[model samples]
Target: MIRKLTKDDQELLMALLRKEPALNLFIIGDVENFGFEQDFMDLWGEIDPADGRIKAVLLRFYRSYLPYADGPFDVEGFAEIIRKDNDIHMISGASEVVKAFDGEINFKQVKQLFFAELKEMNNKISESFSSAEPIKKATVQDVEAICALTDTIEEFESSRNGSRTSLRKTLESNTGRTYYIEREDKVIVTASTSAENSMSAMIVGVATHQAFREQSLASRVMAQLCADLLHEGKSLCLFYDNPHAGVIYKRLGFQDIGSWTIVNM
Candidate 1:
């Protein structure tokens, strides 16, 4: 049976989420900080009637759906939920699970991404970055400039706790790491990590301006970011749909763990 999650279920949720924290990073972080009452969350779970325990977890929020199922789940039931909601912008999950649901519905586009992770550099990577300027961790003062790079600020602000204000709050947190390259007070290249903890982190938001594309700026920032994370004993992970991006990451020592599929409906 699928039902809504309540605050009282936190301990149970954490146990399952911690089992694969990297894939469930965003879900874990959000629920840890806030409970089920957050505006962006439409959290649900599939409970096993036989065992009286949750077998699968689903989060529907921020125009996307993320599902994690280690045991049996109601795939058709969950797909029906997506079928009813007109707001689903993307569906992301373990490749097999996402593909199973994708086959049940028609989406405008589907992206099969490589979910890669790195615990150590395969070889010597330059500790030095030859950029136009030094790349460093972003502070709260640089939040606006960073937000300017993404064209989806309005949607982000509408998505509860994903606003520019939320970005500021994340930067305020010690675990939230956003790095970038700035030129004349404007950010041209950037990389960021979300759902950070002592054990692992999810690396996202790696971008570079069109004009700065060939300068290896993204690599510089990413290498620095991954190096920093691995140095602190955190396994860094990312999802990439672009082969070119994958090539860059492979050179930097990331190995393909599996695929993360995203379907847009």
Candidate 2:
């Protein structure tokens, strides 16, 4: 009985999301598109009404979401959903569900890296670069500098959609946080972290000026940001596209949790 998530369902969805904040954030931003057809409800699943109590619920975008009260969920139903829709992939809390879809779904280990327990500082980049100034939150005046830094990042042109207006709107919102390393008259490096869930934050758009490379500026900025996040008792998650960057994050205390794969169906 899956159906489109209507405005009437907003309260129910928000309630469900309070229980799974990360998934809530992911879906709310693009409920209409969701990378598939067959309406929005085709992307969601709940325990059968006849099952007495609703034991589980799942939401599918291009990626799938499954949260359950019990340890294991209805994996077979999840598989059927994927098969019927031919959705590229799904993400879930239960490892068992992932394993159940192993043959039909391509699985990659996306590391949910964390720094929950801080260790003694060894080469604390922020500390090492004591002369470097503190990082600051970005504002509208910083838009040009931010766009330049984004340009420095190789993948931005090909992968990202939307205009500066859209980016500005997003940055103006409280949900996305952006930071910049200012020096003299310009911003040399920048990084931003979006809270994907109550417990998880995603670090994104870290870039530096070509002349600023090897000076530890990016590391120092990131170290300071990470320290602040750690102080607030939150964990950070980031995706590394290259082994070199993964090595860098590893030095900063991130572990390979798993991988995520996207397929166009």
Candidate 3:
């Protein structure tokens, strides 16, 4: 049976999600930040009648729907919830789970990206980046410079999906953080995290200035960011569509765990 979850279900919900914290980073973060009181967010769960335990979880945040299950789940049931919502904008989750909805949901456009997770730093890369330029944690004052740097990178132009206002809000809320390296008063490279909760964080907006692309500046910045998060006992995860970028992340001890799928409705 499936039912809309309430605050009373928090313990059960977290127990299931924390099983794979990296896979449920966004869901967990949203629950932690918004809880069950937000008008724009709601959660549903599929429970096994036999065990009275949750078998799958689904979250609707604003216009997006995110579903997760460690094994098999009622894809049709979850899809129906999304289908009934006239404001549905996107459906995203593990590629395997999302694929199960192919026949149930009429997808407008689908995008897939390699997903990787890091639990520990690569000792070799850690040692090398140790001598690199000191990285600084970004404040609200750095939002304009950070966005400006990403705007100049051709690779980031089409994929830059965030806004300056949102970036500043995130920094102010303490839900996310950004680390950057600056040269001559200009931001050259940056790495940032989003959907940060107690168990894990999602890496986003890792970019370097066009003139500094091949100089390992991005790697150094990422190393520092990842190290700091891991030190705090949070696992790190990221999605990348570029093979070259995947290679760099792998060198930092990230392993391909699975793929993430985003479907526009």
Candidate 4:
């Protein structure tokens, strides 16, 4: 039976996460904040009448994103839940689920699958190049600056659609981090990371001012961000649909784990 996940399900979900470490952290964190609602279901395979073992589970996010993993569950029952909920954009992992819904509804294999990649950092302090400018962690005072930087990046990359509201949500979360480079007191470059799980994080919203395109500030900020995350003992993960960005990340020691496609329903 598909039903809303309650506080009682937190332990179940966490256990499931341990079984599937690659699950997106945002979704995991979201479930922790707002448990499943009536429109969605946490697909538990089969409930044992006796011990209540949640064989498998998936969090249906606002009927918008459905990710199912860590299961020895009933695929048909899960698909039934999706059909009832509707408007679910995409599901990650398990090709069988994809196949089940392939022709029944509009579906696309457009998610970039990622695995943990490590780059050892040397505590060696390199010369900090002063640009008559400064790099700083974005504060609430820089709301406009932050939004402008994010819009610039999204405009440059058509596939990268980020909302100021969403960015603000992360900024206010306190757990995430956003860094900026300012020149002549004007924000010129920006980068942000979302701490997904205890040990993993994703970098997004990397952008540079138009006039500063060839200046390599983006790379510098990226390098600094990577160093910071590594220092905190978090494994860095990045996603890019653009081949050029992928190439740049490769040069910076990020390896491509797999490809993912996102379908806009």
TM-score of each: 0.76, 0.66, 0.96, 0.75
The 0-to-1 C-alpha lDDT of every candidate, in the order given, reads 0.79, 0.56, 0.91, 0.62
Q: For candidate 3, lDDT tens digit of each residue in 89-108? A: 99999999999999999999
Runs in model 2 lying further than 4 Å from the true structure: 1-57, 61-72, 82-123, 160-166
Candidate 2, 39-137: lDDT as tens digits: 443445454457433344556643454433233556666556666655445455423334455566555554332222222223554556766586888
- Cα displacement (angstroms), candidate 2, residue 80, comes to 3.4
Poorest stretch of ten by lDDT in candidate 4? 121-130
- Candidate 3 has what TM-score? 0.96
Candidate 4 lDDT, 127-179, residue by residue in tens: 34345456688866786776766566545455335455666667787657888
The collision pairs in model 1 are: none
Model 1 segments beyond 4 Å from truth? Answer: 49-53, 84-87, 127-134, 144-175, 182-188, 195-199, 208-217, 231-233
Candidate 1 per-residue lDDT, tens place, 80-139, comes to 887888777888888877877756778788778789888787556545555458887888
Estimate the overall C-alpha local distance difference test score of candidate 2. Answer: 0.56
Error (Å) of candidate 3 at residue 14 is: 0.6
What candidate 4 gets wrong by more than 4 Å, as runs, is: 1-4, 19-22, 35-55, 70-73, 87-100, 108-133, 154-162, 195-197
